[model samples]
Target chain A: MGITRRSFLRRAAVVLAGVAAAGAGWSYLKGLAQSANEAPDQAASLPSAPVQQRTPQPHHWAFVVDTTKCIGCGKCVAACKEENNVPEDPHFNRTWVERYVIDEQGEAYVDSPDAGVHGFESWPVNSKYQNIQVVKSFFVSKLCNQCENPPCVQVCPVGATYKTEDGVILVNRSRCIGCRYCIQACPYGARFLDPNLRVADKCTWCYHRISKGMDPACVEVCPVGARMFGDPADPDSAVAKALRENRISVLKPNLGTRPQVFYIGLDQEVR
Target chain B: MQHLTRPVLLLLTVFLLLGAARWAIPRMFNQISFAIQDRTVPVGTLLGAGGHANVPQDIEAWKARQVQYAGPASCTQCHQESVAQWKVGDHAGVSCETCHGVASDHTANETPLPTETSSALCTLCHSTTLGRPSSFSQVKVHQHAGEATCASCHNPHNPGVQGLPTDLIRPKPSAPLVQHVVVAEANCTMCHGQGRLRPYPQDHAGWQSPGCLLCHETGPTPTLVGASATLGAPFAGLVQAPSVPHVTDGVPSCTRCHDSGAVRPFPQDHIGWSAGVCLLCHQAGPAPAVGGTAVGSPAAGGGGDAPRGVSISTISADGLPPLPHTVVGYTQCQDCHGSDQFRPFPSDHQGWEITECLLCHKSK
Candidate 1:
């Protein structure tokens, strides 16, 4: 009875399946145990510290772009370029100001010449606005929103791009494989491949400066105070006050990246 | 016993062979491997054990990227006087490296830094353009200077009028101030001569000062005073900037509290405003009723000066307490907590920095 070929085959199959199921279950249990171990260790240590020994609160760095205050001076772009060594080419910018001209008919015309390094003095050369009666015109400065849920971070093939504890998303140049998946994944069109470094580059909110407790160069040079960056944990920071006081909105909010860069007086046509 | 031993050995071999086949077969097939990886599994990545080594090395490499700007702090070491002068000057907010170019090399290698004295440099921010905030002091460069360099009349350091008549410093609403005093009154051509370097304008070639009042009477086209109301008080030493209006104790840094993200942040109009000039204008203690915006009035009422309304629960949302000791000077956690070292990590904690340590270790 035991020597039947079909029965022997069935028994062998059962043994193999049992071993495979055990292996899968063991790995799953290990993962659950690891995650569980992490929770209590964190929880137990926090409340034990005395009140006076508390470290500076972990910062939540935020950026505010006051479109109403932004005169589209392009000074920010100029400052950012000088600070970051961004390519001199107009097509590439870590930050740029686009002038949106909305007409009476509800059509919007947008252009950012030379990434506003030269400012928005020059309008569209062909001039679609000339034929149509323009209702209003405003400048919208665009930069990396440093989204809390960063698509660029998700798309990075290597673990090159990461969001810092302070909320700034950074790209590790050494680890970046020069794949433009991040550039394509960004809804805000914030990322650009660095032609010289041959790696993807975007605004870091000047990590070097911010880490050293200084404002980003763009915020440093903006004469009209259009761009502001600070940790929101401190109630007195400009970003906090602006966040609390201003009716702020993010670009392409429908996609829901939860951008840290809040814009005051953002136009409907702005994307 | 021998028959049973053979069957057990045979079962063990069969199980081992099946396990190896299951692991290797999917890895050999690209589509199966891709599905298992949930990504396009590169053969180089799969084969190379160096992938794990890349993580820390790449992180350190990214940290090693040279920060080109040495910042104003570096310049303060040698050029304290210039920094002091520039700090109080109208261009107080503009960092020294902004106009002088990146100073990292200058500080490191004593490289001769560039000094841009051209009007073009001045006009980058100061030139009248459509998008420039009307509050900012901008001028039509051609009309404003008229062939003369800005440094000719305005001091580059402080930028207010220099080397001019004393009364012209505080010009009346209707005073015709001469750019230069008349050297030879009767023979006006001696100073205002056609051969002179800064000759009279083509329109004012023949006309003189008394007759200058006929058209050019309104006082030098009036310095752009559109923002005069909000530009803070007139330059009367350090007290002229703005008053702090709140207790300045405990605050280790002005920007820490006054920055855009701070609770008592400065006005939006003060963009690019630097900390060097904070104490210059804003005297500590309560702000005067007349001068300066009442900055901390709302928070000032809270009695305790601790930054009010902070949601401390959200401070470190990851539930990892800060380290007991500051990691300021300590660069590596492994230096002290390595396998053989003092208070060795719980056999599990990996290498990390202050950025990582603060995720779990609550620091004082």
Candidate 2:
């Protein structure tokens, strides 16, 4: 039978609408399946393992770096290596010191030799910068900011990296796909791929040490008291007092990372 | 089956394929291992309720990781002596485990801990780097000491100090009792003269065979043990200078430590005095009458006449005897006042080097 033009057009339109609805439903289900892959269902199975005992008042851990006080001795870096079992390679520093040498001409020269493990002795090794008359020079120690609005946590596709109730960002090694997404997302460049573990690794502020009522290795070894760590929950804590009293600044204020690490004497040139 | 045409059958096949692909696609490509295991593995059977491997969220699991360093507090119980030494040293601020790695395992298993004593280890902190504060003691590793191990010259326990005075000289194994009956023609000075295999002490310059017999008995080596122990009194009689009361564990700088507002600051006359001059008169170990006797008194002087320039009537503010002569032009302090020199320095100065003369005895 010969079909009428009007009837033929109506049938084609109905078929196309049905196909579009099916496509949308299929994509929605696929998204759910992918999310199921990310959030591991094992949370309910493990009963014997001790979880962090939630206290009445959750701790808000904070770190303060006093650039004025840092001598660039690198004792913190050395101690971090011993405490964290960080690889001996110069490239794998969880925390490092950067020297900012600003000359009278308004040029900034920055260098971190061996991640400042051996200290800043013989710094400004570049012979070209040697003769430059410098107006200001100081050491700025850098570590994971453990940001409140951590881009790392937001970017982890597999829900592997998470922020704890106590405010430290930790990575679940089991679930990480080693995609390097979170590493790139970090604005402060704190994240790195752990060569040995094949996972995204960054500083946890020595989680093992901090949880047990001990200071982080870097904070413990700093002779000049350049690094400070404490719970802002406690009013009398040094970190809280410093944050309240000192003119504090963070690594990247414009990025809105809301970093828990505050710095005293932060220069405008520092990124 | 008869009613089914090519168009109708093809449409049914396409719908079935689309349904299958939607179900299988996630399982095939993505990490749906946990989702698959969630159904098969019963809660707490093989893969726990989470149906995944361990995650660091488990605080206990995270804590289970091996801890190497036990911290400084762990060593204090057994290593009291080293702790005490370190407390007084320039390295007092440094943690013991910084240099000594992974001590927790050692504490648990009694396994031997590695002690890094190489110069390279010292250079880790002490190498003259550009950024280190000038207040910290640092040096150019290559230029400071040519291939010399830091511990060779400086005591690692207290790096600021040098090796003890006793390390330089072995005590005189009291003269071999002559061993045989001496004849009238026997010449003791001839055999025991300077540069001889058994050289006599420089203090016995003019002593002849008879004078030696006064202190040494002519016999077949009398079996009197503990004779050297009793020699402390006689030795004090020979040298009237006061002895250092405290233990001198490689004490290189007496004034650097004692010159400050210490319990017993050095006297005014001793301001520019060097170590050689101090050692020339003062003995090691302890003074004979340190607690009770006054300076330069008969008892303090070991019941002997005070040496020239040292008088019983002259006492400085600290009650020590005043220097008899100006310390100027006495740069070669060991020449006239070294251990067993012409005038003979106290026995403690026996092994001291000429360079150590200025450490304590700076001339005004």
Candidate 3:
């Protein structure tokens, strides 16, 4: 049957519209798949990162921070930058150490000069500091908790920031609208807007490494073995053994975030 | 000419229409651009920039200020000696820029790094503050090397005492006592087994001062066989003095600790000698009188060291006594007096006016 001219025009328009829609859908699918592949290593997608293939493991990961064991070395802070391309601005830390200097008066004054990168070798440079003797000083290391009940995931305007199947909190940069609601929602102050990417960024618990059955860079390079990562479900794991024997606690437990990271010897002064 | 003229006129009319529209355009767009600037711009506008759209400067500078770190490997090329020493040094794991500050811009502009001579810098890691972890060494800044550059006495890379105090070293003749290395896993009951009589809470201040080393040093197992069980005067006299100056200088302000109360008052015997100056009458034993050779009188600065053949009293609290403020052994004031932490040595050899350690202690 011969088509009428008006009908032919209408049919041409419809075909063009279908083609455009199909092309758009295909491109989106390709990007999604690429992102999934890139999930094994956050920074590995970059040209300089060493190529590593992930081996899937059947377990939920957990991290432990023993405050007594932490030396305020700042090694983890430096390693995180190397592993995740974190910015050098000391203020934008993925993980940082807080040195709680409790004076003789029993008041704690916390400071993390340069996020303790070089270490507080000669702090209190002023002689006035000498007058106030330090009483109970210790270090508290902080990072994203990857909470089970993360407010960041719930408050996200779009599903751009969501939890992974393996219980990781992640932001899909492509989908992120940079609304910063997640930053506001995070209780740990772990989230920040990446100036370079203009998107919400935070500690991924080194998703790329964890997915590959490896420890995160911060845990890997800790000099004093203060930070530990392993499958908490396994009784044989170091983290599990530590948890079994010691009294551990999480920050802001009242918030009900159910943070996966636990702390050993958490002091009363620490938040 | 006729055909071209119609097309030209049509194009001119279109331009005229747009120009007129631009002049009379509603304020909605101005408000819309303002809104986009104040809020999230549509995806198309963000990507397109709308050419003249405003953006945060901090975000724009992220790319331009991207100075990649010049890792240790880069510094290794020029600072070969420092790199080599650092690999085996105390801070082996620390990156180069940590102590030197970020060197990426320095590499680009050959900027000088801050000196490591500042006492403050050294104290960041080495200060003898109270709450440090076990194995790390702590120092009272004033008593260290006085004002000398720390590198003068301690090789920063090698990290050992430089120019050994000739007087402090083990003397040539007496030297067979093995140093007991204390392991971390502690169980006091292992040595001082269960049963002990509850002695009266008698005050021992009236007794003679046996010097700082008498009660605070670790020594060979003491012979309680003939010795009195109580940790008082008779026992103090029986305690054998150390052959070397028991590093009392290392714990100068350690006096600050004892000075802060326990019921025990300063020994009455020390009263006639000098107040607060424990070293005047109570001297460290003679040079290390090792195996076989009997310990001699206290060196040139002798102050009637306890009788020879007698070992340092093996009293309570097991053999390991309370830690003396400073390292024990090396009693001669000159041995460490003008050095790090102890510089500005007392004109009269007494550690009296030292409330602030940094006043006397410079980097060295």
Q: List the candidates' TM-scores in order.
A: 0.50, 0.50, 0.47
Alpha-carbon shift of residue B146 in model 3 (angstroms): 6.3
* Predictions' DockQ, in order: 0.07, 0.11, 0.06
List the candidates ranked by TM-score, beginning with the highest: 1, 2, 3
Candidate that would win on DockQ: 2
Better of 1 and 3 by TM-score: 1
lDDT of 1 by residue, A37-89 (tens): 65564343222212111125677888999988776657788878887888888
Candidate 1 yields a Cα-based lDDT of 0.60
Instruction: List, residue by residue over B231-285, the lDDT tens digit for candidate 2.
Output: 3333333433344433322334444334432224343444455544553333321
Off by over 4 Å in 1: A1-57, A71-75, A101-108, A120-138, B1-59, B160-364
| CAPRI tier for the interface of model 2 | incorrect
The TM-score between candidate 3 and the true structure equals 0.47
User: Candidate 3 chain B: minimum summed lDDT over ten consecutive residues — where?
Assistant: B54-63
lDDT of model 1 at residue B296?
20
Off by over 4 Å in 3: A1-56, A124-129, B1-135, B140-364
lDDT for every model?
0.60, 0.63, 0.57
Q: Over 4 Å off in model 2, which ranges?
A: A1-58, A122-129, A235-247, B1-60, B140-149, B152-157, B160-364
lDDT of 2 by residue, A200-225 (tens): 77898888767656678788777667
